[model samples]
Target chain A: MPMTTAEKILAAHCGRDEVRPGEIVMADLDLALANDITAPLAIEEFRRSGAVKVRDPRRIVFVCDHFTPNKDIRSAEQVRLIRDFSREQGIENFFDVGEMGIEHALLPEKGLVLPGDLVIGADSHTCTYGALGAFATGVGSTDLAGAMLSGRAWFKVPVSMLFNYRGRPGEWTGGKDFILHTIGRIGVSGALYAAMEFAGPAIHALSMDDRFSMANMSIEAGAKTGIFPVDEKVEEYVRGRSGRRGRSFPADEGAEYAARFDFDVSGLEPQVALPSLPSNVRPVGEVKGVRVDQVVIGSCTNGRLEDLRAAARVLQGRKVARGVRVIIFPATQRIYLEAMREGLLEIFIEAGAAVSTPTCGPCLGGHMGILAEGERAVATTNRNFVGRMGHPRSEVYLAGPYVAAASAVAGEIIHPARVAGGDRPGEEN
Target chain B: MKIQGRAWKFGDDVDTDAIIAARYLNPTDPAELGACLMEDIRPGFACEDVRGGIIVAGANFGCGSSREHAPVAIRGAGVRAVVAESFARIFFRNAFNTGLPIFESADAAKGIVEGDEIEIDASEGLIRNLSRNETYRSQPVPPFMRELIASGGLLSYMMKNLNQEGKKK
Candidate 1:
């Protein structure tokens, strides 16, 4: 049988020759995970299964970072439920609020996952681990509970889409924009039920940070898992950060791919996903005249320190446009502290940007940064589906941190090049 | 059992957020969820004349996020099965869990174009694309999953199996 990168990964993990899409393959799970928000519910379901002990306590990982530091009574209660469950179940990989970062960031950092592994988590971005060459994806509390009880998951192999990124990115354009452009071309469900493997010269040239960002948003294209072939960069990342070096699994040179995408990165400009859809994209120049009421820079997407620095470099010594609210939330507390140590926080405060604690807020419209009716905002987070950030009537434009910061200062859709020294003297107004 | 349906073709990498947007995260009703099916990902999707048919795609279908609503909404929107080049892991299980059959053929989807009336034989991996009068072989579903799907999802299958076991005991 002709094998694709996805088939290679799944076959490597499950010890299979060929597996079809929609056919159930019961395979051992490398890791099963849930965070505070989903962990409690998983625990409840696990207990309801009438099992005296968890199937494999060591395989289960629980983290508390969604509403970390006890933002409210409910959040605190949720944390405690996970804590008690971990202690009772003897789960060795449980991490508390302060000890945990974002669930997606912390798991890979802990050396708990390896290349060619199959993983499942309770969060949608569980596909984030595919950056390490694993076929990881997300599930709900009920499904996770089943995995917790059995240490096994049933899966149907997905179709594989090979994203062949070519050419070097233009100056000031980042990984976020590349994905935004991919979504623009593919629409929303372009890679539905398929594995997206990032290959080619351009993708290989990207730093690990950039690779993570690329793999992270594959979910946005409606892919099952997005992956990169494990190489020295992955080995070095695991060794340097997690104290473990995983086996590398590069796709065979002649491997089959269902759909092949060749993207040229040259001449690409800062892009945005207009309100209610990631694929509803346009060049930043087209929406330059649009005004904004809010500018948010953070989320699983573009909330890392690099993203903060990019936004900071643009906002330095510049005050936010009057009546335009700029909110920045780092992805994790470590990123928050790192930014503070480097005085990025001060630059944000001085520039009139409201910096909030690390949380999945405004991104989910759960707590902070909820929008009112008829409001408009530009954000660096992934996804801007209707009512995603708050009110259904509120519009959201998705961009990278630099563009997000520039929009905050201009109080509308402004390109980062205009503010970040990329534009010619008389080119942009 | 063999099931027949029309084929609706797509390219690849259809993420869950596109199946059901993030804005509808809190909704639990499958029917209400059906109303918003692929509205954002593919506008006018519901009005696109899809009925009891299979969605054929290139590769990496249902990639982003592990929201089961993606498959549930698609099935609820009158899709009986999805035959794709591949599927996202979560969506694969979610589809079967809800009794929606999915077929895999990297080239199976390629052979049949849009508006192809096809007969799917899941057990044998046989598909007859009536539009092109072509017979293609797809990846066959495992025997165990076929039973679960035939009995209408994992929960219902398990309920019937457990009840039988109880009677035997």
Candidate 2:
């Protein structure tokens, strides 16, 4: 039987030869994750289940990424609870402040998540690991507790949608632009309850960081999971990191799909999701010169080492515009250290940007770089919904790192191509 | 099961962030979270005389963030159920897991207005607007889901099943 990549992964995990869409199965998870915000409640539920210990402590990870460094006393208490529970449970993968990065980026960097793994996280962006050829989906803390207690969780196999893209990205157009354009074309709920299988030559050309950015925002499209096929790029990345070949699972050629979309991004311009909805996308040219008070260049969506280098190329030897506050957060400590060693941090700091420790701070309005009432910001982070960043009246414009860096220099949203003499837009400098 | 309540209408893409803002996430206590429910979008909706009401919303309701706090707040605020044109996937699952009933019916969402009296027969998947004198239907709750709700949420359901299995052993 022909099976989609998601179906194949589920089937393998469930000990079945094949599984059909909408069929319920009990899937063994390779990893389950929860952050400070979700872990407290999950721990409560896990204890309420009358379970003395996690089914497999090694398979569960607890990270204090959200509200890390303790936003306040309450958040500190929450982290303390997670720390205590993880210590008592002997969970080996617990990440504290210094060791913590955004769980999504940190997991892959540490080789904790491998290709074809089935992962469930309490955070919505857990699907970001799909970039590595994993079948990962977000669930509530209750579901996370269940996975912890039993090492298994129920799943309804989602039908598949094929997104085939052609053409290489143009100047200032990278993964963020491609994903925003795709989301714009397919509204917010376009792929509801469906597995979005991205393929075609364009996808094959994307680097691991680019693939992670593209897969990160699948939740914004209401997808059950967004996955890329494991190929040479993935194999190379896995080998470079772990000195071991990564597993690969390609979809059967004749697998059925609910819908198929052909996208040509070679000529696509830089994209920006306007205020209120990620689907309300417009070409950067149309919204260029829209004044922005702040610029943020980081998140699980685009906060890889490569993303920082992209921003650094634009900011090097240039100052951020007066009165525009530029903030840069490397997604994880590892990425932060890499950026420092590569002098990207120096470029950012020399350009009048404030650099902070790796935390999800200010992305979800947790802290640091939050917008004031009626303020507007251009951010590399995903999601531009009303009140997403801070005050209900503030607005966020979603763009790529190049655009974010350029906008910071110009004090308004602008295309990176317009930034005088930057290295190739998406290339590491 | 039959439930009747006054309606509270909301617009499309009423996300989890709006339903329960992140600032108030300190306390996991349902009542504390419920106090600020929709406070950003509908200030005082939770604390006001809106108890035992039904939330009627447009498409893609509860979109954004996988926080169970949204449904927990709604259930804590005494909302009997939510009827919307559609729902985000994680929100749909979280609602059922928390025993917060939700139904998707485009006609019902379109016909209902704030303060209108509404009645729901969840098992039979029927919705009736008493003020508008209109009736709408939604996909019936699956038997397993109904059982989860009847057992007062997933934790309780799991506990009951675990206990039954132990007794059988």
Candidate 3:
């Protein structure tokens, strides 16, 4: 039987020749992950289950990204518990402060997740690994515990949805804009419980960084996960990262899909998901002039090296507008070092943006750059949910790095062409 | 199994963040987590105030994030069950794994008004709005899921089957 990429991956993990959507199966995991905030709860569950040893210590990882640097005593206690648990269980992949990046970024960079792998995490953005053609999805902490104890987790095999993205992308627009536009069109529940297979000439052509950005937001569209068909870009990215030769699964031609949608990006504009919901999006032209109190340029979604370059390109010589607080996170320490080597860090600091150690800070409103009540921010972070960055009334606008940095200079949401020097993009200044 | 409660209304896409904000996640205690349920979007509407209430919402309830805290907070707040037009996938799983009852019935979500008395049966997939003298059908909860709920959650379920070998050794 023909199967989609997700179905093929799930079937292989479950030791079945074929699996269909809605057939519940306990699938083996290539990697099971949790961060500081979630691992503590999962650890409690693991202990309560009378599981003395993890099924495979090396296969389970705990990344201390969420409130590390230990924002508060409570957060410190949580990390301390996980650290103790990791040592007790002989877990080898635990990462702590200075040695850690965001879990979603750190795992892929270390090649901990690979194509055709089945990964689960306590974090929603776990689906970010689908960029590598893996079958990965997020679950609650107890589900993380189940994977820890047995090396397997249950899944309701989801049907697939194919999104055909074609045409050249507009300037200052990339994967973030593509995904934001998609969410706006489909609403937050667009894909519901379906695997969103992103395939098309244009999707396959996107850089790995852009692909990561797109896959990272799969949850915002309520997708089981967003995946790109493995191509040369994926093979090249994985070649030097992991020594393991992971299996690859390709959807058979004419494999079933629940639905298919086509998008034309030739004239697509940079998109900004407005306050409170990622689905509430508009082109940069439609929502310009919304002044921001702060600007954030980093997260699991848009804090990669290329995202930094895009932000630095916009902030190269221009200063961040006075009275506007700008903060930049480099996604990972390795990415931070690479940004420094490329002098992107200098451009960011020279523009008056506060550079911080990589953490999920302010993305979940954890710490580092929280907004005051009534304040508004333009963030490259994936979410813009209510009270996501501190005060309930404070607002966050979700955008790609280019628009985020451009808005930082303009002190209001505006097109990148407005700051990309002399009247570029053919927009009247 | 059946649950009855007053109905609390919410619009579409009630994300995990709205169910329980990140600020409240620092403390994992169910009681502490539940105190502030839905605090971000509707401040001062304490979850404690809606004890035993059925949250009836538009489509896509419990969207965003895989934070189990969302469902944990819901059960902690004493919410009996949730009847929505639909639920985001992970949230649906989390709700069941945590033994929190949830139903998907668009008619119940739309027909049941705020503070209306409502009841739901997991085994039967029926939702009754006593205030309006009307009933609606929800998607049936699978047998395996009902088993998880019956055992008080996945943790208890895992104990019986997962650790038996280790215990024997």
| Per-residue lDDT of candidate 2, residues A1-429 (tens digit) | 899999999999999999999777878888899998889989998897777888799899998988988989999999999989988999989999999999889999988888999999998899998999999999999989888877887788999999999997775678888899999999889998888999999999888999999999999999989999898888777765653445678999799999999999976888999988999999887884599999999889988999999999889999999999998999999899999999999999999999999888878888988889999999999888778889989999999998899999988887787775533333223
The list of candidate 1 runs beyond 4 A from truth reads A17-23, A67-76, A423-429, B1-92, B95-144, B149-169
- TM-score, one value per model: 0.77, 0.96, 0.97
Off by over 4 Å in 3: A426-429, B163-169
Best by DockQ: 3
Query: What order do you get sorting by lDDT, best first?
Result: 3, 2, 1
Score candidate 3 by lDDT.
Answer: 0.89
Residue pairs with backbone atoms closer than 3 Å in model 3 (clashes): none
- Give one digit per residue, the lDDT tens place, for model 3 in A397-421: 9999999999999999988988885
> TM-score winner among the candidates?
3
Q: Give the chain B TM-score for each candidate.
A: 0.85, 0.90, 0.90
DockQ, all candidates in order: 0.19, 0.63, 0.77
**10 residues in a row with least lDDT, candidate 1 chain B:** B153-162
Give the better candidate number (1 or 3) by lDDT. Answer: 3
When 1 and 2 are scored with TM-score, the better candidate is 2
Pick the lDDT winner. 3
